[model samples]
Target: MKHLTGPAYVDIRERALRFVRDELIPLEREARLGPEDPWPRDLLRRIWKRSNELGLLKAALPVELGGPGLSTVELCLLKAEIAETGALFALHVLGELSGPPRVGSLMNFASAYQIERFFKPVMEGDKGICFAMTEPHSGSDAASIKTSAVRDGDDLVINGRKHFISGSPFADIAIVICVTDPEAGPKGMTAVLVELDAPGVRMDETYVPMSGQHIDADIVFENVRVPAANVIGGFGNGLRLGMARVNLNRLLHTSWMIGAARKVYRMSLDYARTRMQSGGPIARFQAIQHMLADMATTLFACESMMLHAAMKADQGEDLRMEASACKVFISERCFEIADKAVQIHGNVGVTKNHPVELTFRQLRLARILTGTSEIQRNAVAREILQA
Candidate 1:
């Protein structure tokens, strides 16, 4: 029943799907069947606890770190398979990255102690994380961040604002990026893990990023002091750490987009086969058949690229060029495939009852987040030129 299953990963896919159908799908259906029935916070907590107990929390993480230590390819396969579940459930499947100005930077460069204190807890599935990097002015140019973290004795005092960070509403902690020496530019940057319960941390009430998904608000740090031990990675390593996270996250994202595309493709195919157009099913029509074939072809190519990139990453191969290549291919192809899926659905595709609409909306985020298609192209171009 499982198609395109790979070595070591196929078993994980089967297990994840069983969880998907039995636990995730049922909960999703229950949530949808009711009028305004969001899963209660407690229920979500319980689901996460059960998932963690089931070893789904870190299926790809090393067993010592409380994960399965799956190869990078295995993680990619699992990521794609789990995303097929749904948005609320996917968070439990793929570990969270508290974004820029957050603990992710520390994960790369923190001292062993700093990592144990901040990064390990989340990777171990004990805590949820969010990133505070994007401010009103400092959109994607991470090097130009304005948040200041002034050193004071054993503490670093932070001051600035960040917006559009997801999962902050329920996160136990966050990664905050701040400029330690404004004069030194990006080289003076540092990332600190600021506990949400810490002093001088405030969430602005009105800064809503997205509805339904794990969207949160503006974070204001007014002289919030973090101990020197909390400094993530090396001095000025925030930029590189941020870059690595962005590059690696694309692989995870590749899995999710592929999952969404699969859903869209299935819906499109079903409609094509059953929905009558002229004298027979629309699937018989050349127009619809062409769309279906194109969709399938794109999926194959994109998934192949993703798996190749993942395997390379697992082998400690240089993945920058590959990540950029995969992200560009997956993101652009996803839009084309999703658009075709919607077209096949005709009028009803716009409605909420159809999954394509939601997939369409969510897939759009792929183009912007991590790196834009334009940005990916630029990276690819540079790599090609250097080669």
Candidate 2:
């Protein structure tokens, strides 16, 4: 649900914009460096701690839970601001502040002891958690994951390898999705809380993709033993619990995409208005104007879809089809906008020095990372044809 009103939201948006403009944007140069650079880590850690002190760390939580708990509408506005800054800032400010993908499920489903031992530390920023679901062979088909968790006396022994696990290298704990009963199909899948430091848990490789600062990992669990009580929402409820939490995850992705799209549009517009061309600025050309206009129009459409879906979610309305539609439309359109932005800047935009270059890489990855556009379309069609 929405926690902030009209003026309050405006204030929050303005504050976020200022933070990105005045504070985060200044670090864009250093943020673009590869993971081998030590400065980015130190800087991100400093900003993360400062963000907590400024009370900007709990944007992912709902209002009832004591965070500003911005509504989906509010998140759209705020994320756009953060996304425009750069990937490092987006990862540190929005990604870190929002907590992990499984935070909501953990809050809703974890037992008292689980809450105190695991959930609380994550919420308080004392630690981080990663959602380990994607496997080497499985991406969108989550139910096909082959990781097995078998009961062994009072403990559950988990064995398998998780690939493309975001935040794994930095996470202290992980919510592992595994097959508990091969005969039960989807119902056989179960969610277990695993401590990364536990014996037999190993993160051997870190994958640094488009954004140099963000790290994904290949995690291996070789007969890793987790307490029987660590099962979230009980055994055999993994898919059900995941479906409940992923709706918000999809919405958050839209917010991040739209935000970055807006940034590129603004940057392109500014460049067109000032860059000298044949007798005048490029902005004077009808072609440039049309491109700018199209970018703005597309961004507005994405925002409308995102806001509408978020509003419906806040009102407790089921938006499965609408959410899928938003995911597909926004992701594709955002990439288009970023591409147009690079064209507008010509050679300079293609350089590693430009923020647009980094933005282009990140937006391109967004299309495939979160349920791919193809998978989202399939989901929309299934819902439509369902009896």
lDDT of 2 by residue, 1-387 (tens): 244346656666666666667776666664675423433344655665655555565655576554676676776667766776654556556444325334764677889999899987766666677888899898888889899999998999999999988777777889899999999999999999999999999996646677553467788999899998999998899878777757667877788898788888999999998999888899998988988999999988998888888888878887778888889999999999999999899998898847788788878888987799999999899889993
lDDT of each: 0.72, 0.78
lDDT tens digits by residue: candidate 1, 1-387: 134345446666676678777887687677763311333545555555666666565565555555556776777777776776554566565444332123433444567886677666665556667877777786767887888888899998888888777666666677777787777777777767788878998877464322235456688889888887776776676665656567777777788889889888988988888998667898988888899999999999998899889878877887778998998889889978988988999887877636787777778777877778888899899998998
Candidate 2's C-alpha runs over 4 A off are: 1-46, 94-101, 211-213
Worst 10 residues of 1 by lDDT: 97-106
Error of 2 at 274 (Å): 1.5
For candidate 2, give the lDDT: 0.78
Best by lDDT: 2
RMSD of every candidate to native, in Å, equals: 3.4, 2.9
RMSD of 2: 2.9
